[model samples]
Target: MSLLFNSYPLARSALFSLDAETAHELTLSSLQKAYDCRLTRGLMASRPEKPCRLMGLSFRNPIGLAAGLDKNGAHIDALGNLGFGFVEVGTVTPKPQPGNPKPRMFRLPRAEALINRLGFNNKGLDAFIANVRKSEWRNHGGILGLNIGKNAATPIERAVDDYLIGLEGVYPHADYVTVNISSPNTQNLRALQGQEELTGLLAPLQEKRKALADLHGRHVPMVVKIAPDLDIEQIDIIAALLPRYGVDGVIATNTTLSRESVRGLPHAGETGGLSGPPVHALSLRVIERLRGQLGIAFPIIGVGGVVSGKQAQEKTAAGANAIQLYTGLIYRGPALIGECVRALG
Candidate 1:
């Protein structure tokens, strides 16, 4: 468990002084203005290109911004300025809904972790797509991945309908799409990861993907994002199912539900997925298990708690084809992006 908090200590101190979610909003708003003023590039580290090809798309570097940080695609061009080769935004739902109650996000500074129950709080698909279209990131050769999920009020049984809508809506705009099935904040959402539910979701999802591919004249890949809390048996089941159902890749894994590593730390008992350094080992284990079960050629984007360049290397070593950073970005700032990219290189 390394400290990304080490890189931008003073800035992190200031951001940490506020409530976590407020700091998040303030940071994104600040980034937008900074990018507009053409000052973001000046603050970023040297982003030497480290080209990688995966899921039939080219990435300028393997280090990407993970989904939750830009839940509506509003910060794409600005975050792209942070030296990430790619940026994935939104756990967007078909309709907009206010998420979990206030104070749903908590910080564990000593543990270098965060607990969030921010369910998929995003503007509806229409606004999300409009924001995506407004970005110049893709024109500059940055890869974009659109992450989708069901609305909180959507019944667990009819979840596939929401995902299908999300799939169809995002296909034309995304370089790739991520179907997020593992966020713990949404009630009973993890049930979608079960064998019966997964097949039900994937079959129709891929079927729609084929249809969308024909209409768009481009075969955009569909990636599944799974949780890090899975057991070996669940991993085995997922490995067998992914290729059979035509999933282009799997992001192993999402923020964890376990707080065993930070039991005594502040906010340790908060209700939400815990992300940051404490999750690094869990994420690595999931990646290794997936790689072992899925074989060498199957793509895995390892993410959970990455706080340093060497930790980034550890993910690749554990069988991640690419690595994503979010919680680390919170603690370390943009410098962490270049650090991970160079280490992966």
Candidate 2:
């Protein structure tokens, strides 16, 4: 094991002592420095290649670092070194905005969960694209997924405009672009998931994507990230529409507003989406239903509550073509990446 992995337990202890968002910012900043100095290279555990194809792109492995960890795409090289098959960044908007007030993020250690209402706080498209262009990983063949969203001030009805701007801005840089209409933090963002609203949103986006493909001479697959709070009926509706709209893939879950699992835990009543072990079964159920509805060929990226190798395998067994991690990284460190990769293999 590398020294960084060996020291994480101690590091986690110290990080856990601080507030959640503070610790998160500190960690990302440190990682940015480590990556810039090349200190993070070769620190991850070695794993044999287990390449897989998804959404017309080849992934080095099926395990990916989920979005929201590096909203600006600033830590791509550093995070890429952590053994993730791919690294997804941003929930960026067309313009920068300060998200919800402080203390918006809460940690539920007992449930191995986190509740966050930090509405798509990011440096916006220009800064985000600049960061992506500066990343060394871009030239080195890292599978990068850029997640885009509407600004908080944008009305729900006009949300498609923001998404179009975001798509145009990051289309050339991303291996795949995730349309993040599922984050609970943004007011009424989930409204876009409705049958009429979803179609209205996806149809034009698909047309624009075709134009972008023609302009760039490369087709970048567009995936939709959905919430885990939906029922089987809703999942089936989404599955049916995806292929109709020419969507390349679907990320089965973002986070959930349901608080059934952590009802009595600290911060359980916080108004935001809950992620981690509490959302695991819900995510699996969505993936299972999506697979059944979309058939075996359509791609599904499963996320929520994957903190161990066992959970990672369970996601694949439940019908995930690929898996992503976020809350798990908060609790397990980078070692979890290799654990999931080896388990998936």
Candidate 3:
């Protein structure tokens, strides 16, 4: 733990000092290098023990690298080597498009959070899957999830089509699929959370999921990613809809629109979804609310603002079957993964 903490300040000093996007690029490149090095494979193959099962797939650990960090599936194998139990890639769209713009991603070190209106940017589905297939970077036996979303230009009425496309395309490649309807960017995207609207949108996707299962001869679980801005009734409405739609699980709370914790920080006014410590309490609230509303029958993947083992445990207690972190990964580095796993264990 001390050695892991030692690596933090140096990586933080170097990475955080750069513009947020550049820092992200540097981090990805570093993972690419580490992937090429066989960083943990030799250590693991020499003595294999880590494994976890979730959503019908076997994982190597409970700690997973969340989506948005590897938006294009570029580093699955490389990232897998870094000690994550699982890897989720992309909030991918059907077509490739440039997200908000340059300065779309911002970092608030004081809050340990990120504000990104990155708006589903990626190399599109084809390119993203190409990278994944080319990499052959399976974690020997780790779980992988494909997070799907619609393009900015897609009309809200037809969003289901895009999700179906992603589901069909990534189904053969993923352990499970995440339907991301919660991002605060893109026009009227969050409106899908409304009961009637959510049901309408999910029905077609669920139908498609079944068709894919029939085609592939296996059932693939579909989890819905939700926003944290909902009131209890709203949360209850969606919770009730999950079992009706045959959805597998829910990713409670995406980047928040609230700035309560960092109300006066320099980046406080940034027009994007906020993540990190500032989101901890509210994210946990959503998790607890959803769990309470839906009961223990459904599984929940708790994310947002988790940076320590205690925070992860809090999420687990709040009813998370598994947990993920993005901001903490940036601030605390690789060692944070080890810490969360050990603490959660």
Best by lDDT: 2
Error of 3 at 124 (Å): 0.4
Query: Candidate 1 — what's its lDDT?
Result: 0.89
Q: Worst lDDT window (10 residues) for model 3? A: 40-49
Instruction: Please state the error at residue 199 of candidate 3 in Å.
Output: 0.7
Candidate 3, residue 311: Cα displacement in angstroms equals: 0.3
lDDT of 2 by residue, 141-206 (tens): 569999999999999999999999999999999999999989999999998988999999999999
lDDT of each: 0.89, 0.91, 0.84
Query: TM-scores for all candidates?
Result: 0.96, 0.98, 0.94
TM-score, structure 1 vs. true: 0.96
The whole-model C-alpha lDDT of candidate 3 against the native structure comes to 0.84
TM-score-better candidate, 1 vs 2:
2
TM-score of 3: 0.94
The worst-scoring run of ten residues by lDDT in candidate 2 lies at 39-48
Candidate maximizing TM-score: 2
Clash pairs (backbone) in predicted model 3: 52-59, 61-85
